[model samples]
Target: MTSSAIIQNIPCTLVTGFLGAGKTTIINQLLATKPADVRWALLINEFGRIGIDGALLKGRQNDVEKPNTIAIREVSGGCICCTSQLPLQIALTRLLSEHRPQRLIIEPTGLAHPHELVKQLSAPHWQTSLSMQSVITVLSGLQWQQEKYRSHEGFQAHVQAADVVIINRYEQLDATCQQDLLTWIGTLNAQASIIWAAPNDASSELTVAQLSMQLNQPSASISKQRATQSSQSRISLTLPNHLLTNMPNAGNSAAMTMDDEPPYRYHDEQQGMLLAGWRLPSHWMFAADELQQWLLQLPNWQRIKGVVHTSDGWQQLNFTPDSLTITTTSAQIDSRIEVILLANTDNSHINSKVSKNERQPLIDWDVYDHELMALLAK
Candidate 1:
């Protein structure tokens, strides 16, 4: 195809899922298997300001010398659907104009609503210029069984808007659980093609033909109005100063860079949720058993996700009100954790039960830090 033709009709695919559903894992697989002849651009969004996902995708330690074929842009501190929409558009436009990539892949923050993004791309201005491909939503098999996810409106919106639903970590489910998951997904989105696959294994099933599937429903008109409405929220956290002072440097100096900046304090929100996150040195390894025990006693956070350095190896942690899954995975840019909390709910009951003015803490950060220090000392 000629340059003008390619620029006018570049195929863009949107990959979305709830927090820690392995969307990045799928994206990485697709990139690894991409045709050598086809150039691609990647746009990643994160809820926190530190941009861990971007760093990981760009290959942090060698970011300066990374290849130029795959253009990457990250919009951090908020969802692309709301506060960062303008930035997203500018970055996307610039990426396309400069890189002239044949394919574009977008990984929106897990908390984002798909309808808003679809509406943006389907608008009159971009309708003729960009060819929107199948909107893929990844689901965790374990998370599907949880009532919290089943009842969430944002989660339902993602399912309803997707053209292809890929369920990751299905290997963890039994025959009965697998059947129930498929049944539930069908009830919510009968038009979408549902595929069962493991993380990093989706590329085999998500072939070019499968990704070319067209949307069954028209973009909803209400999404434009919803996009303008703000659901801003905030999370307040207190971490021990001693933990930051004593952490060691990462073992692999060439693999990643440990950020010295303090934890982010952003206030923007998405889907009625707010995030509080911390970036820890990669050398700060957690005791596996103690970490799991602490997670069990974690307070009422709506969602939690991070890549941690454990005594055994690197592990990915995914947590929700009803489920928590920890599986060994490769090391990321750093050891970091982000907790998402519901901001619009009343905390009167929690405060009264705990103390007259004390609110329910998300996690005992001080205790966690102390435990980590002791673990590293041994």
Candidate 2:
């Protein structure tokens, strides 16, 4: 196909949400249920250096009846909306050129701002190259009730920029909570279609045609009262060096050390909080009990999610300030974990230490790394 034909025919869907909102789960479901004849390409972006989501999706692909038709690429360490833009463009162009997929799906890091991404995709250069479809934003009703996340600029931006808003984990909400969520979402995006789906529900399949139809309908008008809110509330927090650096023997051994001047940290700032990540080798298996104990003691982190190999099998870890849930999951290509911490602007401890060459001393990397290495050594 000619380049012009490829751009006009391909439909790209952007899936975005805040941390732990089940974005990966939804994407996996969509991929599993996709038509057997259609070729799909997925570009997943993560806030952490380790590509845990990509691994999980690949695992899901293995279970599908026809896995060969799908192609996956991962962009990690920073939000693609800013720091990872060039990488995204290069990867996307390559995926399109190589696969010639009928559809494209992009899952940006939870910390990303969707407006910037939409702007980039809709630029004049890509106008003839790609047709933008419905932008889906997934939300957790329980998290929506939390003042901390509800007030965050990045969360609000996701709501505002979406053409469709999905409320996952809807089964956990009561009638009043559901109504409150709908009301709040309506306030942010009047035009976007809203759908409620249970977490990991196989029936919730998103397709290119469905998204395209939704885009064609008239949307509700967004209120201008908060037009300036995003700009005013957005704060760009610098990611620590440890999160951007890659381990020397990444997937080869159970443990490894980092090198100096790994990848220069991406400086583009967004509207979200901070992230700290670790990439461990596939051979390292965590003792479930020990990992849980360590996670429980981490009171400073707001959200944590990752896939790790355990003595029993593969395990998935999902943690928040108030809860910790672990379940048996399939093994991934490697073990990786990322924790979302309080923003630098909000925490006095982080704010006081912000400097040009230094990262905020929110968490001690040396001690944390040592503890993780010791845990794996056990």
lDDT of 2 by residue, 1-378 (tens): 545554554767788898777776667666665677888889988776656667776776666675666888888767777774688777787888877888788899888878787767765556566667678888887788789879888789899998788787667778998888888888987878887664454554454344335433322221121233211111112223353234334342322333412211111223435555665556566677787677656535667877877776788887865457788886666677766665444432333554686543433444555555555523
Evaluate all candidate structures by whole-model CA lDDT and list the values in order: 0.64, 0.65
Q: Each prediction's TM-score against the native?
A: 0.67, 0.75
Return the TM-score for candidate 2, rounded to 2 decimals: 0.75
Q: Residue 120, candidate 1: how far off, in angstroms?
A: 0.9
Residues 233-349, candidate 1, lDDT per residue (tens digit)?
A: 332322345444455442232233223443223334456565656565566677877766655554456667667788879887767654577777777656766667664444322
lDDT of 1 at 364: 30
Off by over 4 Å in 1: 1-6, 60-66, 171-183, 198-272, 279-297, 301-303, 307-336, 342-378
Off by over 4 Å in 2: 1-7, 59-65, 172-174, 198-201, 204-272, 320-333, 344-361
Each model's total of backbone clashes: 0, 2
